[model samples]
Target: MARYKNALTKYYVGDLEEKEANLRLAKWIQAVEDDTDEEVEEEAYYDGDGTPEEDVISVKKKYSFEGFYDNDDPAHRFIADLEFEVGEDRKIWFKQERTSGEILEGPATVTEPKVTGGEASEYQHFSFAIAWDRKPDISKSDDDAGGGVEG
Candidate 1:
């Protein structure tokens, strides 16, 4: 078991190798998802009497700005597009050929959105452990070198 002195940090990310890179990418996605987004809430109020003297019951307004992309391939350019996007203009086109592994990039609002809807939601609580370049089973040239905090 590779022991880390502290939780995952950018400092240790430099050592990540191959598959581990993907794992780190996944973690970043999770962190992004956990972040909250800004939201706008609208509320209305009414009273039994027309005058303010009467009791008034109203709903408090709150908005959740939290937003997250629905996709299995976190590496997809959509996430990057959302970040680099100048404004929240919905118009955008994401042309991608997974089979050919080719992607053509364009402007966000300038282009039409090729992204679709009907993404399945993740239900119930789940736990995930990320693994990157962790072939602990395979022996390395410098076996103990950088296995943990110590090189």
Candidate 2:
């Protein structure tokens, strides 16, 4: 038997611990995208220059979450909360699933929401971007924090 990625699955974003805050929101999410890039600077060494040295200056990561916007859904409240605290730096993790162990987490600020779709077939969607400053701390599990308790 083998496992493969499926379209039906949704990604999650929440605190460091596997909290239920965003767990329920994951169900209403329709799409997820992660963008990462490095800022590099090229330096010329006059002492012994063969090829210009390229040094990584910094890294940037942006996470985008898109979902249907239904005021009736409880997830809508989560959106309001995020919007209300736009400039605040909140610890957030991007996980494939609520139960999945592997995750990328860091301090991020929520951006303004973007809405689309006002047609009969298309869905009314709400999209937002979370901008992170530091490199993500990837964790396999809460127990990945070195070792303490046995389970």
Candidate 3:
């Protein structure tokens, strides 16, 4: 059996061009949540059987990130700036590197960050969600390509 550490996962954000220089590492992230929602339709036919048929109409993916606020971090700055923008005119590229070495990249729309109000003893924190503009591109890791290596 193979085990992986969550700390090894990496996240990044950049311009739509996807240039290495423009990519900013989101190292300040303390937690991340990936969500997938499926839209389904269920129908019951008047056949002899009393069973309902279900079909998945669509799938939506979103990632929510929470972390300590760092004013100096470029990725943090970029996301903060978007809080003032309206609509989806501005979109950014997002990339995720899993501990298993698989990669997922895609264009996404970021939501405004919700800053938490804490006591003097607590650190400042912010959380936001990014929704994929379309289906993300996934690249298999070398281990997965060679054989069955759990990610």
Best by TM-score: 3
TM-score of 3: 0.78
> Global lDDT for candidate 2?
0.58
lDDT of 3 by residue, 1-151 (tens): 6765565667777776663224454656887887777899988889837688998998888888888877778888778777777665458887877765687788888886765667789777878888778887888766553323345
lDDT (C-alpha) at residue 29 in model 3: 81
Name the lDDT value of residue 125 in candidate 1: 21
Candidate 1 lDDT, 35-127, residue by residue in tens: 222334444447434333423343221111112333554533333344434443332322211112222222212222223334467322222
The all-Cα superposition gives candidate 3 an RMSD in Å to the true structure of: 3.7
Cα misplacement distance, residue 95 of candidate 2 (Å): 5.4
Clashing pairs in 1: 20-132, 20-133, 37-65, 37-66, 38-65, 92-112, 92-113
Write down the TM-score of every candidate.
0.17, 0.61, 0.78
RMSD in angstroms, all models?
20.2, 6.8, 3.7
Give one clash count per candidate, in the order shown.
7, 0, 0
Q: Where does candidate 2 stray beyond 4 Å?
A: 1-3, 6-10, 14-25, 46-49, 89-101, 115-117, 142-151
Using TM-score as the measure, name the better of candidate 1 and candidate 2: 2
- Candidate 3, which ten residues in sequence have the lowest lDDT sum? 142-151
lDDT assessment of candidate 1: 0.27
Which 10-residue span in candidate 1 carries the lowest summed lDDT?
A: 10-19
**lDDT per residue as tens, model 2, 1-151:** 3333434334455664453236444545677677666899988887866678999988787767787776666555555456555344344444443234455555555576655556788887788876665665665766433223233
